[model samples]
Target: IFTSTDQVVQVNGSAATGDMDVLANHTPSIEHIRPGVVEVILEYKSSLALGSGGCTNAHPVSNQHINIVEAAPPESFSPKAVSAKLHGALKVATGNGSEEEKIGSRKV
Candidate 1:
């Protein structure tokens, strides 16, 4: 069984116990499944191997595709400049008032 939510794809079930091969497409099932127009692909393969004790073992292998988008760069900032601006604003807003007065004035 396969379940899809947003950009995430999940497969639940035991492939080792099945004989069928499964392949998934990269279109509506995976494309644009989330916030962004990302695409994903999933493939599963299973094989049975013979053991020395006359027993058979099943093995499963899976392949996945993940596409990630690059984020934009952030604007540059100067800590000293920001601090100076904040200090000037606080001084203008508070004047000679006490800390409690300033807090009370800003309360909603």
Candidate 2:
């Protein structure tokens, strides 16, 4: 089990055999990111957020292939992504954002 600080909990790629769990201090490796549903499970004591994506920071030696992967925190994920697998809603607003930017809650 991983805690809140455990960033980049999972990476799902198109060629990946299956979903894999990621934890802190993980061994360095790589996976072929596929265009599939990437679920990022973040544990908030009071809130169980089922979501997508990755953290900005990766271990200098960690196996990270970001280009082929779509990573974002739950708060920024569109209602579709949240509702698709996890039955929940995350409401956010992007003051000056494009459609996708709004989905990711990018402030611009």
Candidate 3:
């Protein structure tokens, strides 16, 4: 268990998956076992596909963007101190072009 002076924590993107735990510098209680620590399990909808679409003699049909975020109590040691990280992949499909070409041409 860790503690922090801040009151909030945030996690973003695909990196927030499965079981996760955080520790902050705050008082611990029965409910807040790990006063500064927070735990979360992030998930994405497998059914939802993100990307673009195209077909034979077809043009750009669609585009999509998906984002996820998680927040927790901040640490007590340094209220101003904050740490964050993000992970995810952008998927795009162009029927006429290869996957590599489609991804390489686009700006991430």
TM-score of each model, paired residue for residue: 0.22, 0.33, 0.14
Query: What order do you get sorting by lDDT, best first?
Result: 2, 1, 3
**TM-score of model 3 relative to the true fold?**
0.14
Highest-TM-score candidate: 2
lDDT of 1 by residue, 1-108 (tens): 123332323322223233322243222222211221112223343222221111112223233332223311122346789689778667758675577767766789
CA RMSD of all predictions: 20.0, 10.8, 20.6
Name the TM-score of candidate 2.
Answer: 0.33
Clashes of each: 1, 6, 21
Ranking by TM-score: 2, 1, 3
Most lDDT-accurate candidate: 2
lDDT of model number 2: 0.44
Worst 10 residues of 3 by lDDT: 50-59
Runs off by more than 4 Å, candidate 1: 1-75, 96-108
User: lDDT tens digits, residues 6-49, model 3?
Assistant: 23232212222322222222233111121122332223211212
Task: Looking at model 2, report the run of 10 residues with the lowest lDDT sum.
Answer: 44-53
